[model samples]
Target chain A: MEKKQRKQSPQRPAFLKVLQKSGLSFLAMAPLLLGVIGLVGLFQVLVTPKMLTSLFQGNSLLDTLIGTMSGAIAAGNPIVSYLIGGELLEQGISLYAVSAFILSWVTLGFIQLPAEVEVFGGRFTLYRNILSFVFTMLIAVLTTLSLQGLS
Target chain B: MKKQDKPFAFRGKYLLLTVLILYGVIFLVSSQSVQLALLKSGTILVKILPIFGVVILFTSLLNFFIRPKQIAKHLGQDSGTKGWLWALAAGVISHGPMYAWYSLLEDLRSHGMKDELIVVFFASRAIKIPLLPMMIGYFGLTFTILLSFYILLGALLQGLCMQLLQTKKM
Candidate 1:
């Protein structure tokens, strides 16, 4: 097996040698990302600030869950998340909900799940998203409490 | 069933095909959706295309100039807090959609990045260091600092959890 590996290792031209594994993975990423982009485009249409306002009622836990659910469903630039996070805060939403929205908007990626699966594999994607989602809510709660303590 | 296939092929072309089909159905049901989807995707692509190009170019360069062994030496299991800091800084400084970084992260993983660092990278994205001033404007400096710290804390814990769960096997 070692001899066979050695025999197969050196057939590349010098120019192509540098574009081996990383290049191959980069090549694979394109198609996988196409679906992720497609899903994100569809989801973007479904999420709006009006839709978000409907989900929050100032209750910390419930707001956090709704914020997470909405965040997971939406995809955008982090700047957009901050803008939306500010909007959520001004519109009578609790700090917990706003924090959850911003956190998960940046961290979680239901739309990118397939791409993650393609690149990192299904199990890792599932575990990572679940943990991120849970921690997003936790961070949201903690952020609210810390704010309270500070004030 | 001829030994049963793995369904996803690791690259997830199957998932892309499924999404394509779903989009097709949407287009057929309402041609307006085609316009909407196209517009959204076009804008996203326009904004990200440059970054995508740079990232892919860097990946090829990295593959050529650096050996996977060197990558492992810096970012692999025993690289310790330095690896974590590298990941945190990378995640914090990065600006753009998550998908834009997926290819780069995959390339890194192929070259021996630890799963924990990947988790840390994703988690630390919540920090948004450049947006700190704006965040403070909305929520006050104290709230912003605490929130950012909590996010960093969460990233560390999530990375640790992902590591403990053995996500690398996937």
Candidate 2:
């Protein structure tokens, strides 16, 4: 019985080892997380909805392009994007523009690119971002058209 | 048991320092805005705390019970349609800031998860379950449902593109 109990001791240590590894991983992630939060805060204060809204000119193609660009640059919380999207719609910005903005806001992250590249490497990050950018435009158009059809 | 790389660790610290310095400079220009920014940042930190804890615990549990072989089998290069489904489901359910999941995804990648699945996961995050109500409130129910559907479709489309490109490379 004593030998059996002694053999089981290794299992407890294994779990402990996992916990330690996890703790270390979280510690290592601290700096990157803080930096991302700080950058997001700066963006929130620096870029206003009015600034983003003013850039839209009501042309479907141009506004979509601008909207995608703006969202990519000002990437942050989805909640914040919704607020800005609401404001833009109230200001008469077309759904095409607003949809593009909201979609890119969540998907593309020029600001977080460095952190992503750090974790996922350069090539993968580049491909993912570019694909996301293209899809944002495509989906935005489809979503708007679908909504129109549904209504 | 691999010694984690340390060379790039300093990069994270440098990024934080640079951003802090920027905050300091901006503080001098407008203290109120800086204060507001700090408050907002604090609020964000608070909101993510619980989620972060859960993530760390989940990651540890994953690392403990699931081996690299299992990860490869489920999310690996040959995981096929099942892998795509798994990535989409995980992305839809995941909450908190996307950056929080980066480390876990990186770990999974090292364990043989495909880049295509990773792209799928990232793209699928566009549909936030908790925030769906708010989205509907802002943009009618039909628009919300349609947008959600398109986002899922887009995610899979992006994943397909990534896989094609990766295969072409190999």
Candidate 3:
């Protein structure tokens, strides 16, 4: 009976130990977390659509490139991406431009590089983002072409 | 054990200082944006913290209850197709900011998750099931479907590319 009781009690300490370690790890990571949040917050202010829309002038192809650059600078939730993508389309931005912006907005993370590097490593973060950035443009152009073809 | 050999990878102080300086410059240019930035920060923290806390707790519980060897066995190198599905599902369902998911991802990486799989998970996040209807409404069904397929294809390509390009340093 005492042996069973002892066994059950050990499980609780095991969980406690895990909790303690996680708490410490969270503390250790707090600085990085705060830094990411701060940077993203600052980006939120500076990247208002009014300020960003003007940068996307020129031909549709040029707009596509500019849109990719804008999206690569920061990221947001999918709903936000969709809403912005929709609004841009309504505002006379070509589907090519808006689509690239949304694509990179969801996929790329130049600003999140520090946090990603902390987790994955510098090479992976840097290279993967570059690939995602390139792919965003590729897919956006392909998407626009395909849609046009269908129409 | 290998994790200890390296110092903490994130130098948050430097990053924090960099952003603060940028904030100051932005403040000089537009005090309104600065105020907007702070307000945005507060709501973001409120919205993100709970989801972030829950993921951390889940990972902690997982770390305690499950051995690393078990994790490596299932989600590691040998996980294969099942692993891909697991990653894809997690990505599609994940919520909040991408950064909120970072710490949990780091935990998975330490437990021997492959780098390619990590890329798959990140890439797959572009697919949000809940938002599909809204997307279809805006872009039309055919365009939406094709785009979603492209996003998934892009994820697979990204993962495979990472696997091929990355050296032993990973």
Candidate 4:
């Protein structure tokens, strides 16, 4: 078996070299990727945590409705949601608020607008994203209401 | 220089011009609050940098390891109900944002998967493997199951819609 495997390994290095080269490309892309991250971070800082707190302190349903809209505009990975979720929860935000925030964190979010628009076309992407946000909030509201009933 | 060696018109100079134009437009359109939010979230982005690197590396590795032909052989249209089931099953097991799956989906698309299956892959992302148990705790087992089923159903319907559009294009 060892001898047979050795016979078949002749072309392995040629292919492996490409994979090895991609590693350097990944490293080179790191700073550009990090710069994009910093840009997002700047957006978050500009928004101010105080504004975020006030947004969720309103009537639970309205908070969640608008939260969904806002979330669609600010999409990224779920870690952002968890951090923002924890903050909202700490500020006496309701379960509905947290739920909507979490859902929109993933389902909605405008961070992908440029890329999405590029792929799916500007009008289509905008409409679909808006529709997704609306549906998400609707689901959040229904889920919260249903949970309340169950309790 | 060989014909293939020549770059496309969209590359190099054209790309730079496009980027510069877009940046100027963005700067003009953005509000004060938007600018402040970017600054505030800058640290958060820095912290998540390592995780993004790992995720991208892992995704690329998975692409390297998982042969598209084999994936399609098991999950192609002729696989019938089982194919759809596996697409949803596989999607649930996958991680990262929906956008992360774009390349994989494009690969699968080339490998004979239908638009419906792609839709399922995108929509089924609502199910978080680690968080499902916690969701059950908060919303009850029945509710969780129902919602999951509903999402799958939505994906199926959306998939059919995409198929219809494709047929129209054809």
**Each model's C-alpha lDDT?**
0.80, 0.86, 0.78, 0.57
Model 3 chain A: weakest 10-residue lDDT segment is: A8-17
Q: How well is candidate 1 docked (DockQ)?
A: 0.50
Q: Residue A116 CA error for candidate 4 (Å)?
A: 2.8
**Model 3, span B1-170: residue lDDT tens:** 33452333434667777778888888899999888888877777788889877877887888887777777876798988888778877887887667777777888888888888888888888777888898898889978877777888888888878777875444
| Fraction of native A-B contacts kept, per candidate | 0.60, 0.65, 0.55, 0.15
The DockQ-based CAPRI class assigned to model 2 is medium
lDDT of 1 by residue, B1-170 (tens): 22232232246678779888988888888788777877897788788888887777777776666677788877897778899989988888887778788877876886689998999999998877777888888778888888889988889899899888994555
TM for every model, in the order presented, reads 0.86, 0.91, 0.87, 0.61
Error of 2 at B72 (Å): 0.5
Return whichever of 2 and 3 wins on TM-score. 2
- Number of clashes in every candidate structure? 0, 0, 0, 23
Error in Å for residue B163 of model 2: 1.1
Instruction: Give each candidate's interface RMSD in Å.
Output: 3.1, 2.0, 2.6, 6.0
- Candidate 1's TM-score reads 0.86
Candidates' RMSD to native: 5.5, 2.9, 3.4, 6.5
DockQ category of candidate 1: medium
- Residue B32 lDDT in candidate 1: 86
The residue-by-residue lDDT of candidate 4 on B68-167, one tens digit each, is 5666666665667777787788768776655444434544555566656765666567678887776666546866765566566655655566556556
Candidate that would win on lDDT: 2
Alpha-carbon DockQ of candidate 2: 0.61
Q: TM-score, chain A, per candidate? A: 0.82, 0.86, 0.80, 0.64
